[model samples]
Target: MSQDLYELSATELSASYAAGLDPREVAESVLARIADREPVLNAFYVHEPEQVRRDAEASAKRWASGTQLSAFDGVPATVKENIPRSGIPVPSGTALANPPVSAENAPVTDRLLEAGLVLLGSTTMPDWGMLSSGVSSRHGITRNALDPSLTTGGSSAGAGAAAAAGYGPLHVGTDIGGSIRLPGTWAGLVTLKPSAGLVPLHAPYMGRAAGPLTRTAADAAALMSVIARPDIRDYSTRPYPSMDWFKGPANPAGLRVGLQLDAGSGAEVDPQIAAAVQRAADLFAAAGAHIVELRPFMSQAQLAGIDAFWRTRSWADYSALEPEQRENVLPYIARWCAGGKDYDGVATMVHYNRFAQVQQETIAATRDYDLVLSPVAPMAAFPAEQPMPVDDPDLPMAHISFTMPYNMSGQPAATVNCGFMLDGRTIGLQLAGPVGADDKVLAAAVWFESVRGDAALDWARVL
Candidate 1:
């Protein structure tokens, strides 16, 4: 029964109640799975089994009374640590002692809870979400579900790990750069970084968006429909009308796609990763979609500008911490924060201006195409507990070359598991669309997933 419960997706689990399976029984199976796996994967930072059981019992009662809230009622889901959930500590992946618990739920959390999705716990992330690798000073490191020696990627580290390890079928993670995609790519899952303002963000910053990491693009679309609903709290929330994201596009029979194999910069992509992306493009071409090779739209200077913006923003957060608390942060994160201390207002503004120009160029370059395709990262997951894959300590941006450009442009982008490397690491093919074309982007992903079949799904279940 536990094995059968573990195999069910969130959508399937929700429907199981109608098939005579109690939500409480399913919840117990999930808790038991976590108890067996959490010690090795380190996927969750804090989970209250008692609280989860109580919520499950309530959901079962609702089911018995024919008062379920949504299709996801009684489904298990995990939230990233940085997002606030009432009564859970928002550690933000830091080692600070007795971090204050959240007094209220973040907008995303509220939506999930209101839908009756059971909160499993908060997942781990790098300190202040500063690094792409899974290592963190607060919770040590999150190991890849496929291989214990490899990283799960970050700052959505544990969310990816939890999803890959079969803790649940739905998980939420935030992406400022490649946080969600990086982990999704490494963990052989599908993740979407919805366009800016699609998901209500409190005190939003440039390039930051909250989204889902799941086993299938269809599941991501389902979660997005609920979370992207209008919230009055986020002043920046777009007034866009809601659509049936779960249905995606009816088909991708006549879409135009632009493909870029390399960034035209010094960063090199692994052959396996590039091949996987090409295979995805080929699949689209076979589906009657027009595919054109595109030149790099972003320059080295533009990339540097984006990096500077993030560094400056991170520094501001780090510098605001109490001196002793600052010392508790990961050394790499601290160093990154310190690197921005010397920048004057003028220099920072110059970077912002450059970033704006880059964003415009990116939009204009891909405007003719319905979608853009590329590798999610330059390579697969690297060694666990490391900051990056490169031997050079100075080139921290090497692995992020492919995904960060979309973040700067505020476009909707998603990464789907396309294939795997010889060393057992997964490769992700990225699908991106212009700002506010999130549905189109996800539709293309779903179409590709249909063609790709369930190879990645089978791999994920290897646990």
Candidate 2:
């Protein structure tokens, strides 16, 4: 029973454990999976076999006494490297000063532990959670579980891989750019990027928020309820009535939706990806969502200029690093920095103002829609071995074209498999809602996940 449940997702495992599988044995089975998969995936950097057993044994005892911590108490999960666990060293793959760990548990981790989740270890993240792709010089590249030849979206690459590989019941990841969503989308898993500041980001990196990448959307919602508790660490965390959230698995009905078709730059969305987007839209329409296709806040000219402006910001963060700081820095990062020294503050402000105007206009447009949908990336996951996409310059900010603006706007966004591409990779379609409507956005994604079932991605067969 434990072995069977180990292959299940946190949601499925929970359902099984509740049905009488030994919780302790179930934890050990998951640990076996982790040991079996870790070598190639490189998903975990530090995990002690002994501590894992202790936690699992404790959970088993709780179960025997009818004292389960929560539905997740005995489940195994991984935290992103940047999410400090009391004594863990956080070398975000770069050196400015080694960003130290928090003396106490991060609010998100604390909640997971309180709910009885077994923290397997920390997953790899790009240096300071920077960049779009998972390739890093610091802690070697964390490859896509579906295809080691393909890239995993970063900086939450390890979390994505672990979920895809079934290393644990759930994978805890953080997203500022498309971190959780991109990797999950690419890996054929479920992801949730909470509305900004909803998950407290303490210590190592202060700005980004944390969330989960799982095999099911319900797990994301469940994790949300646990971590969304008020914390003095994050001053901007939302105070919504979350007690009733995740209480049910209701499907979205009659929800209002908007679709952004022409992603501004006129970069042709791949044929397969477009079809997946339409498929998702059809699902929404059938479910009674009033679907409206509209162009919002992006135009050909505006996006081309934005393509250049956003790339420049990457330099500010990476350029701060000393040569010694980035021994593992990917080569393309240097190529991007080649001409950045010439950019002036005026050029930067021009980009900032344009972003401001577009987002302001977009907020007005979103007023009528409960959700806005688009493709997660202009292209599907590309080969991992290549340092730069041949279309490098064409990639706005060098490969992440569609996911950044929302991060800039602090909206709650997510990516899930829309369908499979002609070449055999998954196409991730993105959907977003205004800053605080996370649960509603996830509800729609959950409905789509059910409809798209097998179309959801995982690389078990390919890997």
Candidate 3:
């Protein structure tokens, strides 16, 4: 192959395997890429190259005998460290606790292994997966693959960096409040946060989900096809349905798309990001889709309520740890979690109840449109050392206003790179749909990709 194997998409790898391409060679290419980029990016918490080689060799033999486990057999992939895989200790981005090796695979890990995708290893995250930035106690800072000075947004931090740096085609990331999409924006990739519970998870929360972060929408679709299978472990998920993820909407014609420029309250949207999203909307309008401007659906009260509740939640976890263990947590995360200690039961309940209001408002606001478009985050990439765009523990969630609402609403949202900054940083456009509309959201992303064309940043030129 003229192009390096490390750069092949999951779709391309599947075809190559079917045509007798050795999985071992692909693994070697991936390993080579990791060797070149991992030192600079710090993208992986646990990467065992020998294990990758062994897995690939097994896959190569399976391909030789035409006994491959699935269509994507032997494709390289990585899982976020937060996701449990048997025998892998899930540090969860904090050194505060000594976690045991998992006895069983999480639904996402099980599905990927069962599908014959070679597990490249686990990526890193921030403390307890709380922060939306890459500054972590356990893994340090995971820099953006596009620019080392900037962050690879988190808590799916390493997964984003790995995907952007060509660390293979498939990466599994968990998102509750823009973890996947924010990083994807910074890295210029396709990130899908499937409707809550659409993808089975072991410890299902109200809005937490596991989805793919990949270079292309097609690869994200390929991953979803495998991981979206229903598992009895997660009771929160909807019944699995058959869907053709590869095919997108034929065109944008006749679709009513809502353009949401304001996030209600938080950091103001950057001018460049705003312009990029407007340009994206114009493109859709040109294709005959009816574009409607949307008013802000969120408010500072709602943002504060969720923030208070989450802080309390984090404190509950921190309080359970030993005193020494608590000290090991990152200072920013520790201070953030400490804020929860001041809340009384009534205050806690009041804050927690805000999610319902957020859900109601989000659904009501977008119910009229087939899809909504907004900037994934308020700003482009920021310094890797900071925990969030605002860089304040008290205002930790100020940047998530746009992405957080959908999680509360249980809507399906995706981040597809729509444009780039003059300096080459990516601007992600969030495409979201109503609850249970995962298929529609992904289909729209695929359609957008068709017209968005190639990204300006060169993947091969990563520092």
Candidate 4:
């Protein structure tokens, strides 16, 4: 029963409580599984077993009384460490910890609690959500579920690893530049980076957005419907009507998808990844969607400007840290930050102007299409401990070339596991839609999942 309980989806888990499966037993099974696997996977920063059991017992009562709070009642979930939850210390994956526990939940955390999703614990991340690799100063490396030798992609590293390892059905991760999508792609999971203002964020950064990483598209939608609600704390948030994302587009018959093989950064895609993206496009084309090949929407100069903008933000944060505290940071991130310190106000404005231009061009390029498709990363998962792909340390953003554009445009984007590489590492197909078109992007993802089937979820269960 314990093993079987661990295998159920969030929807399945909730339904099972009424079908004679005790929530307490399910919680214990999850705790036992975590105890056995945490040392090897390093997927969690903390797990409160006693608290989890208490919550499960209460949830079970709700079920017994036919008073379940929501569809996710008693369904296990994990939140990325960067997001604040009441009583949880958000170290932001850094060595400098013992930060005070949050007094209240961030909007996303509050919604999860309100929806009755049982949080297992906070997952790990890179220092200050800095790097794409899953290695962090506090928790070390979060290994990939499929191949432990490879990285799980970060800074949403632990969330991706936990979801891929079947720790739970839903995990929340934050993305500034591909944090959620990259990890989800590398870990063979479904993830979304909702349009910037669609999901409220408390972070000081402008582009960062919180979203869901799950095994199925429907699960991602379920979590998003709750997390994307407007919050007064986030002044930038805009009210969006509730959506039924589980019932996505019935088919791709009327969707227009623009397929981009490269972003014109001069970096070549690994042949295997390109082939997989092509296959995904072919599948959509065959399903009655009109597929159009897209040219580079932004020039190399514009792309580089976006990279500089991110580094400039990092520089501000890093420079403010005490000198001793900075010394404890990852060398790669520290060096990246140091490089940005020389940019003057005029240079910053120039980059901002370029960023705006890039955003305009992206919107213009996709105006004719319902969504755009590309490879989530240029290559498959690399070694677990490295900050960037071993051969391209100087070009740190190369791996996220296809993903950062949407982040800059403030458009919704999602990654779906398309197929596996010859080395067994998974590849992801990225889907990006116009600003405020999150539902359309998700609908297309669900349609693709229908075609591809839930093979990734099935594979992860046995890992």
User: What stretches of model 2 exceed 4 Å from their correct place?
Assistant: 95-102, 203-207, 247-253, 299-323, 326-328, 337-339, 387-395, 398-401, 457-463
lDDT of 1 at 76: 89
Rank by TM-score (best first): 3, 1, 4, 2
Candidate 4, run of 10 with poorest lDDT: 453-462
**Residue 377 deviation, candidate 1, in Å?**
0.4
lDDT of 4: 0.82
- Most TM-score-accurate candidate: 3
C-alpha TM-scores of all predictions: 0.95, 0.88, 0.98, 0.95
Give lDDT tens digits, candidate 1, residues 152-265: 999899999888887878899999778999998898889999988899975587778999998888888878877887788888788776656866543666888899998855
Go through the candidates in order and give the clash count of each.
0, 4, 0, 0
Badly placed stretches (over 4 Å) of model 3 are: 453-457
- Model 3: C-alpha RMSD to truth? 1.3
lDDT, candidate 2, 398-442, per-residue tens = 334456556656677877778898778888778888878788777
lDDT winner between 2 and 3, please give it: 3
lDDT digits (tens) for residues 222-322 of candidate 4: 78877888888888886666656776654788788899997877367989989988998998989898999998776778866777777888889889888
Report the poorest 10 consecutive residues by lDDT, candidate 2: 386-395
User: Roughly what TM-score does model 1 have, to 2 decimal places?
Assistant: 0.95
Per-residue lDDT tens digits for candidate 3, residues 292-346, read: 9999999999899899899999999889888888888999988998889999999
lDDT comparing candidate 3 with the true structure: 0.90
Question: Which pairs of residues collide in model 4?
Answer: none
Clashing pairs in 1: none
